[model samples]
Target: MTPLLDVRELVVRYGDFTAVDRVSFPVGAGETLALNGPSGCGKSSTALAVLQLRRPDAGEVLFEGRELTTLTERELRPIRPRMQPVFQDPYGSLSPRHRIRDAVAEPLKVQGRWNDTDGPTRVAELLDRVGLDPSYGDRHPHELSGGQCQRAGIARALASEPRLLVLDEPVSALDPSVRAGVLNLLADLQDDLGLGYLFICHDRAVVRHFADRAIEMREGRVTSG
Candidate 1:
């Protein structure tokens, strides 16, 4: 069966510097794949390339059997909802001025699916889904703890009902105690929602606990483990 997401010979370059060098991988439905490596090993670049946040100089990114590289930004817009990202820095990813409801609903709004009446209700549901109370929706990122902010980010990512979620060091910044809770939340979300995850991190222990399979990267190339 074809994988839900496929990356073949992905090479990302910034001028003369090669960030990701011909790395290839596949992620199937409901499967969690971890990309592990030290800093500047292209793990984040690989994720960005898949999300099309960073255009690859060379390679093929296929999502649900369609080649994303060939699609124009306008064409890729609809597919964006099917793929979402949760960045490492929860504090930076969220807007300090916007309330949790607005932050969570931003994706839907950008997709032009926001409703004046139902948007808040849906936002509340998502906040609840991510382990935050509906009342937290009134709070801004600054008012929440690190874990809560990350939960908000996760809620925002899920707002689109994405089939595949790319989590770039989703729990790396949190305290050890808080990390497990967030990790458990992710696992529960995956099992309950059947969401596929591309969990990127350098921490082997976290990756082993969170991912079904782990791929190691070194110097922009996928290392054989």
Candidate 2:
């Protein structure tokens, strides 16, 4: 079967320094593919390149069979909603000034899908889907616990109705006690939605248990799998 996401010969650079060099991987639908490595091992760099947030200097990022690297920013706008990101810092991922509901609703509004009649209901459903109470939507990021904030972030990502999620150390910032819950939530989401995940993580134990398959990276190179 064709992979949901395919990256081949990927390279990312910062001035004279190369962060990711000639890396490649494929993530299938409803599968979790972990980029496992230590800090500065280029896992995050690969995520950015795949999202086209930082365009790759070399290689191909094929998402649903379309090449993303060659697309202009405007051309990528519509596609962006279909592949969302959930970052490590939950509180930081959300706007401190905005209520949780607003943050979750922003994606739909931006995509021109919001209708006053049902938009509020959709946001509530997303929050509930991520295991957050709809009432929590009235609160700001700072008002919620770390795990709650992260759930809110997931709700925001789901609002985009993404097919693939680029999770950049998504559970690393939360307390260990809360990590499993978030991981389990992600697993359930994948099972229910058939979503693909590019899970970037440093903890081998977590990757081993969470990922369907994993690629090990070191100093910008794929060292093992």
Q: Each model's TM-score, in the order given?
A: 0.98, 0.99
lDDT of 2 by residue, 31-149 (tens): 99999999999999999999999999999999999999999999999999999999999999999999999999999999999999999999999999999989999999999999999
| Residue lDDT tens for model 1, 66-154 | 99998999999899999999999999999998998899999989988899998888999999999999999999899999999999999
- Kindly state the number of residue pairs that clash in model 1: 0
What candidate 1 gets wrong by more than 4 Å, as runs, is none
Please tell me which predicted candidate would have the highest TM-score against the true structure: 2
lDDT of each: 0.94, 0.96
lDDT for 190 in candidate 2 is: 98
For model 2, the superposed segments whose C-alpha errors exceed 4 Å read: none
RMSD of 2: 0.6
Error of 2 at 123 (Å): 0.6
